[model samples]
Target: MADENQGFMGAVWETIKTIFWALIIAGVFRTLFFQPFWIPSSSMKDTLLVGDFLFVNKMAYGYSYASCPNIKIARFGIDIDADDICGFLDGDNTRVLAGEPERGDVVVFRHPVTHQDYIKRLIGLPGDRVQVKEGLIYINDEPVKVEDGGTFTEVKEAQGPERRFPRCSNDPVGEGGQCVKERQIETLPNGVTHSTLNITDRGDLDTTKVFTVPEGEYFFMGDNRDNSTDSRVAQTSFGVGFVPYENLIGRADRIMFSSAGRSMLFFWTWRSDRFFKGIE
Candidate 1:
């Protein structure tokens, strides 16, 4: 009887040790190499969807110990980035390496005001002059070329009582009311191309003053032009203004999977086409 009890105790201890090692390994990998991020909004619409799951390459910009501790562990109840906006380095904490994002990269960063993580396309780099005129992007006084794609329609099955949803004038003049948006292909100066949604042509954000990116800051914008509150608006106005270099967490590498917010058990809700899709 004593031998049986000892055997059971030994097995339990071994199981605990195995679980501990597994967690440590996963945590280390997530901290140093990559971590997953989920898209919860339509800000990146055509490029990314509301239910898209992406693998953010943390190593893309190196690791800085001066950055705030991972929220999962720190439990600070704050959404701030690990690093200070000014890139201040703690005496004992140093950057593990160095890397920088290019103009067309899609990055995840911490918002200055809300301190929440946001993903957007990098539009303006340091010292670049950026502006929007008549729903077009102008960088350094040169217009970024755009090709007309066509209209994009969003279909939904009403879950509750019918409600009215305000829509852009250009939306298909549907008798029953439909959600529609204009789609266009945007070509960046670096030749990288992506699609953008233009819900309206004359909204307040369609035209803006020229923004000269500061020495160490960057400007990002969402693909859903008319809906996203991005760098186009001033930080004081509750928008994500110029982002600092240190606020960047990682570059979005690829979409690992997607769902339509329905139960995972419902296989029909799985967006199979988006699985393992590469973000342009």
Candidate 2:
């Protein structure tokens, strides 16, 4: 009987060791290779949508302090930010084996002041002057090419887990009605073209003063245009100002999976078309 008990105890110990090592491997893989990111807002509409789930390529721009995972689960009262894990690497604004990001690449970076993760399209590189005038972007006094791409339409209803309703150029749209926004294809100086949405012709951000990006910093903007609070607004005013290179976490390459419903568990709401869709 003693022999039987000893054998059972040995088996349980082995099982525990296996489970422990499995968790360690997963944690290392997530930290060093890829980190999962879910689109929680409509800022990158038409390119990325709410409920879209993708893994950020941590190795694309190499490792930085911002590459550390920031886990925040409100229900569990657990909040661990990237700074908490890699604060030693912060302040220097440098990445190990850093790679330069292109002008039009969609990037994920930590807010300089808030330290929160934000994803937007790179607009201005270091030492570049960026400005918006009459709903058009001007880089170094030269207006980038913009062509009308007709209207983008969607249902006027609560979307995703936040249940937020989308804004429309044709406002006053009732629930379940068609919400519309003007779409325009913008070609950057580097010839990278992407669709941008405009909800209003005369929004506050439609025109802005010339912002000369500082050395080692970058300017970013959202594809949603008037809806996003990005580099156009200063960090002191609660917007993402110029982001430093080290704050960059990674690049978003593609959408691995997407759902339209409030919860991902609702399999019927899955968007199969967006599965494995490459981000332009």
Candidate 3:
């Protein structure tokens, strides 16, 4: 009996040691190699939906301990190769000025006003003039095209209401204060093209002042346009003003997992459809 007791204790110690080592390895890999982030807003909508969990390639750019705790010589975040980058360290704690976020890449950055992490597609880069005329985005005096993904189909929420627009789709024309939306391809100065979404008759297209993506600063707008308060208006003055580069977090890579919000205390109510759908 005494021998048996001693053997059990030894086995337990070995198991604990194995678990401890595994945890250390996971922590290091998560911080230095790849990290995870979750979507919490509809700002990116069809591209990256809310409640989507994603794996960000930390080494896609680089990392410094400055962003993560328990280390010195901190790195703000990874510098992505694309305009929009993802894999945020901490939502509120990011610095963007060190690098240039590319055009058309969907990125996760710190909101200028709230300091909260927000993911938005890069429409204009530094030294470029950005304008939204009739929901069409024009950069450097050229029209950017948005790729069409077919009309969105959605089911109305209760009652005999109009058809519902799917997550990636926008309603046509403004009804219930929503504008008609479409997808088009955006072409950059280098002739590179990317997809974008727009809502007709929405947003303040004509502004008294022209916005130039300031040096060491970035201009951003929500894909939702009229529904989002971005760099268009002054942050303290009612809307998001000019965002500093320091507010940038990281670029979004891809969707790892997605699930619906079901708070019911049952197993069958879980969201199963969005489990592995890639972020488009």
Candidate 4:
């Protein structure tokens, strides 16, 4: 019986070690190669939709990775220990990260203010004048063409006992969370532009802050124009006022998968039509 017990213990230790090594290898591959991301918002509508699953190529832009970059905390190979001044992942320009961001590509970044994740198109490059005018988006005086219309509906239903229900409808106009509006776009003299609503004639963020698109910074804006709180909304436009190269998370490559409305239980609500759709 003692022999049997010893054998089982030996197998358990071997299995545990195997798992540890496998996880370490996988983490390294993902960090330096590709990382997966899930979409959670509609800020970039008519482009990337809600529920879209995607993969980001981390190496494309080059960012360093270490077990702990900014944490003074240490691990005992099994648990936590005491602390010290945190050391960052980069060892004084180790050159672990490399590459440049391009124009017109959809990118993900850490929100300068909230530090939350967001995705938008690259527009205003450094030193370029970025502005929105009378609901039209303009970059260097040229217009950013947007489709005439893009509207989606989100629906919710109530079950028995919990409810006096609101009316149910397939039409977007009557559906909750559904929005319908025309967006306008235009370009600026320096070539950076943004979007707006065609008839939101007088908006609070119409002008001012004639930024000279500082060097090493980039500008970003949502495709939904009137509905997005982007670079135009002064308070949240940091990093991209403009976006320094370091702040970029990754570029949107392609849609892996997406669910319509909100839930996946409703098979009919799936955007089967959009499956494998190419992203611009």
The best candidate by TM-score is 2
lDDT of candidate model 3 versus the reference: 0.54
Off by over 4 Å in 3: 1-27, 64-66, 69-100, 146-150, 157-181, 190-195, 204-208, 236-240, 263-280
Candidate 2 segments exceeding 4 Å error: 1-8
Tens digit per residue, CA lDDT, model 2, 1-280: 9999999999999999999999789878877888888898899897898999998888888887888888788999999998899889888878887888999999988898888888999999999999999899999889999998999999998989999999999889999999999999999999999999999979999999999999999999999998887999998538898998999988899999999999999999999999999998
Give per-residue CA lDDT, model 1, range 1-280, as digits (tens).
9999999999999999999999889867777778778777777878997778888888887765423334543576664454443246533323457688898899987776666778999999999999999999999999999999897776532211222232444554554455778989999999989999988888999999999999767999999898788999888537899987766778997999987653345567788999999998
Query: Candidate 4, residues 178-245: lDDT per residue as tens digits?
Result: 44445444343434344433324455554434445667667877765544566665544343345556
Residue 118 in model 3: lDDT: 60
Give lDDT per model, in order: 0.78, 0.91, 0.54, 0.56
Work out the TM-score per prediction. 0.83, 0.95, 0.63, 0.69
- lDDT at 149 for candidate 2? 96
Estimate the lDDT of model 2: 0.91
Give the clash total for candidate 2: 0
Residue-pair clashes per candidate, as listed? 4, 0, 28, 19
Superposed model 1: Cα runs more than 4 Å off? 65-69, 72-95, 157-177, 263-265
Candidate 3 structure, TM-score to reference: 0.63
Assess candidate 1 and give its TM-score to the true structure: 0.83
